[model samples]
Target: MNFLRRVFEHGRFGFVLLLFVLMVSTLGWKIVDLHVFDHDFLQGQGDARSVRHIPIPAHRGVITDRNGEPLAVSTPVTAIWGNGRELQAVRDQWPVLAEALGQKPGRLSERLEQAANREFIYLARGLTPEHGQQVLDLNIPGVNALEEFRRFYPAGEVAAHVVGFTDIDDKGREGMELAFDQWLAGVPGERQVLKDRRGRVIKDVQVLSNAKPGGELELSIDLRLQYLAHRELRNSLLEFGAKAGSLVMIDVRTGEILAMVNQPVYNPNNRRVLQPGVTRNRAMIDVFEPGSTVKPFTIAAALATGKWRPESVVDTTPGWMRIGRYTIRDVSRGGQLDLTGILMKSSNIGISKIALDIGAEPLYSMMHSAGFGQSTGLGFPGERVGVLPNHRVWKEAEIAALGYGYGLSVTAVQLAHAFATLGNDGKSVPLSLIRRDRAQEGHQVMEAEIAHQVLRMLRAVVEEPGGGGSRAKVPGYHVGGKSGTAKKVSTSGGYTDDAYRSFFAGLAPLNNPRIAAVVVIDEPSKGGYYGGLVAAPVFGRVMAGALRLMNIAPDNLPVETKTAAVVPGKGGRS
Candidate 1:
């Protein structure tokens, strides 16, 4: 009993000890629960923190011209990327790292903040390799360089319309780049990367994405001819005080487009300096009244149907024919002229009369067969099928005027191709802007004999004294063609007072012709506005150039055979 009493006296110390023991036991139970009972949950949380993601880039394809000239290419560049966790842990050396990278401390602070919040972020894009190496020498925690592609145009402005340009992401934005974006942009590949506790790269377990290189694209444009045509067209546009100009050269035998050029051109490489009109491809997109250039088709149609012969006389004594409310007048008061003289003078009366004889049926058929009123099938974009009112839309006066190159629209290419029909022995083939080295099948409209005769008459049109197209005469080559001028369309109605479309379509070496060309001047208000004055000289230069290039030998034949060659294949065309 006495010992129990003594132990009771020390009960305060025992009570304090008991309370401390209970507090320690409660804390131990909680630590056990967190470390053992919920071990899987804590492990999952730790694993989420240790995981990291990285990006892999795909390489785009290269673009080359027909002769393997590089239009666009991809080059290697460096990207500055940072690791958020590592940079946060090594915050002490940040000022030194910023000084080495030539950046202010505040800017780096913002970058660090972004890295902490965002798993992946670019500190810099499209930096040069040298710049990247300088950044790497700092050995800044969490910051490194990445590989990327930067687009480049080697030709610069040489072939901008063909090669196209790309955005900063290496995506095709314009021209063939946009047209063939699918082939140029390859499938992107990806991989999953692993990191240790300190965020250092450890091991790569699996690849989630496969890398692919873009496919190649080859163009049919000849770089040399394209450059030549662009140079000449620019000179002409500047010299003539004209708004713009376009020229196209076609191979008579193969239908390959040797050259196509338009002024107000833009270099695809320097797109920022270009206007919308500069990028327009007028050779295919713009359609205008081809003036007297269209007369050959009517003359050919008249001769082919046996309705009118080249020697056949027509009463164009008055030089004007009044029909309904419209009066059709020739360029001059030509006396009674045979088909040959009428064409030489570009008489509206003679062509109108011939159109009446042949009727709307044959005229429409000839134009359609000549590849007018339809697309050229050149395999490029931005081409228009020129507007030609159907025969069903033809009224008496309208149809007659259409015969003289009015009330309808056609592309310069189509007009050149129509004359090519006569030069090609009355066969109409599809016009090709691309380089085609194979045999192309053509559709025959007029027989070879009739086409031969028509060629002769066109030669007479150029060879005759005081002829409108005398400027088209080429040395060492017999050339024949027609000249035409039409008042341009106005916003109000009828024709604009001063605006005109001057045009000429010609074939060289009248005997066994080889090449054909067309020249057009839009709104040419220069000193000489006539097609004979403004457009024929252009034809002469281009025709002579083409003849020399093709090595077409001259025909030393007498004027008789040359004249007879103009005869219509079926009728007395020449």
Candidate 2:
């Protein structure tokens, strides 16, 4: 007790106690600072190193034909990525990694070097699950896989121009894919994730939002008919050695496009050979002078005047007629012919005389009313509204040219739409790429009687023995069609003599028209370039298959014979 009192009195015990108190206070203050004042900062730093909000990939919509056949689909795929900073540390393993990824070691190293400062970098994208799993099994540092979707086209190049294609990120780039991208692309979700230092997700903490999957799109196209058209058009292109071609088929009842195809197509699945010319949707985007196909509309124009009938005579004693500096000549002698006979012969002089007499405004009115010089309202990307010059003062030659389906331009779809209007009793219906629940209402563009008369005239062009469109006949169907071969306009100014655009536009089963189609072949280098020879045959085969596929009854089927029936009671002679 005396020693303890001595120590306390000397201040040594108090000094030791003060030192202990100071040490405890410093530790307590440090604990408070870490838990309170510096808590958010520390937590934020940790989160910056390990916590992440990653995107939960949303799948693109499925595109289907009218019959519910899948055309375009999105398949789940795995893409490999890495933390460039971490990957740089594992440079020795890059050769093995590069081999598994089917990449050159040198290239992989170079890519990694370029991205060494990045926290995240794509190593390999669009990998199959098995392939990605194999890479992950190696357990290479900094390597990770993310879920993604790759667009797959089942139709390949056959429907490439129609369905279009998507980019690496699954965004639409062309065709209906680009046209309805918003509707087809869904909203991606967000999720909180806990990641490691190497950028691999260790845990999925929580989903901030749910992914909304894209909606399904059902197009009006019939896959069967599309295949048929595609096959027939491709054959014709090969046969004629044509530079390019386009074919369009429409359901006249609903104005729904059954099939639309273009040549020089590219595979949406393989885009290595993608070029603007190869991927062009020519049926909707490109235009050419329709040539003589417009004669039906001119006849309709004449009929609308109330002065000309289907049987009205036009004197064309000479085979040629001079207008301005150009001379219009017929292939055969143009005798005195009624409108029907003139259409059958496809006489340029005869049609020209009718046009010159009717004047320009009337012909323009007819063509304009037939859905020419306008968009088809299909909402297609880059669709051209063909040029129909509505010049206030029309030259005499221009008037004649308009009568013969020249001096203006039209797309294959536009020409098909016009013929569909004639098949629908002169009502112009809106063209559709999407499937319609029912037939939409249309406005009458011509008198029903006048339209019927024009249909009969068109029938003469196909049914008559010497008709130009005789090759377009379906075996057991009464078809009405017109053929046109227009000279391609030269880049300098005048028309090119060697280059020609062949076209055939018509509807099948004239009695009750169900389908209307147009075929246009650009620059047929071999065989023949005439519309009847090059385009009409294609139209015939495609239309025949289309009619059969749709189960349309043949209007020209031979009449059934009545069998003589003798009842068993006839023996009684009642």
Candidate 3:
């Protein structure tokens, strides 16, 4: 009663303030009861009743050869993931869990210990479904598995350089795999899985994620040609004891790459042994001075400028000439060589004189027009745009050397296409490795007459016994080509006297050329190092097998001497 009387005396405002303080105290006590004491238990209960990630792996599409031979295929597999929070909840058993999963206790302890509070973590990726099931059968807490896709390559080494493999996570890493990653990786689906306290999923809500099939890519390569070239090139590498070599076989008429063979080839399936050197796609990635193979381009340029003809003769005195500070000489120097003989003998002085009169502009323009400095746009990974100096940079000696296939760098594929242009009648077109029908060839880059004349000059090279590329001739097929030996340029400057890039570029059935090719050897340690000795024979074997495989009929009549029949005629190589 006294308290009520004092409140009435103090007034209504003071009494109201007292009532508000009592109400706040009651609410604050309730809040304390629900928070500090019960916080951890409440969180645990909520998580135990909450949803978890049910990883639904996407399917990886297939990689196949042009003929439908499987290069890479997805095999069903299982990957293990863990609820880091749950694992940490039972952190004391890290060693036992590690032992059960075939992992070292140290490694396992680090992982679980680190992920103790994390919401998710991947324990292992791409385990075989069988192995995954074995793990699941162990029924350990916190660990879970999912059926995933694992990529496998059956053709292995045969397609290793073409179709690259993927990572353990099914992501494309290199080769066509990386180039077409979007198409190769199918869309993944998702599902909802309810888990119990043991971390085992109690139920799965099906979420179908149908995979979109990848588009099939057709290649221009014939497996038979690929196999033949592979076998022959491999054998040559072993027989010659050479460091490395590259061969590119192209269709003269269409510019299709039939077989791109390289030495030290690795299996795409098992790429563990691949080093940077062996894995380089030399035909597209590496460049070198083309040697004598560039002779045809020079001859074609001179002919285009109206300064020379097949019959034009140049007196190559002493077979050597001092142009500026450089001494230009033919291997067989000092001869009165005609245009045909010049190419047949690979006369450096003769070609240099022609380049001198034509000057650097016309020749460079011709080469540019021939697609020398440009990229082939092959969709090749790490492909380089071969180096071609500007006309303004042509020093005196450089001009002479450039005229005879020096002072320039080109890829094996580039040389093959340039020769193909001459085969196509002075019209060089873009070369493609993808299979295309006859009608899709689009345009022509060489004049038929010019192409025919170039073919005639090349024929002289093989038909004449003393011709530069005489070794490239095959029996019953009128073959034409040029030989080149280029001293490698050292990084410190100048040139290395011993290291050379031997090269050969030619076409078959000179009457109606259907295939053009280039064979290049880098640092061939073989005893005889001329292009004629080392590269031309490989070109011959490659062409012979290619001709037979491509079903190109022989032009020359069969005779006792296959070499005699293919040699230049009464016209002497026309």
Highest-TM-score candidate: 2
* Selected candidate, larger lDDT, 2 vs 3: 2
Q: What is the TM-score of each predicted model, taking all chains together?
A: 0.75, 0.92, 0.85
Among all candidates shown, the one with the greatest lDDT: 2
Q: Report lDDT per candidate.
A: 0.76, 0.91, 0.78
- lDDT value for candidate 3? 0.78
Candidate 2 lDDT over 191-245, as tens digits, reads 9999876667789899999889999999999999999999999999999999999
Q: Candidate 3: which stretches are off by over 4 Å?
A: 1-49, 52-55, 88-107, 110-114, 197-199, 439-444, 559-574
Model 3's number of clashes is: 16
> lDDT, candidate 1, residue 359?
84
With a 3 Å backbone cut-off (N, CA, C), the pairs that clash in candidate 2 are none
Off by over 4 Å in 2: 1-30, 33-45, 563-574
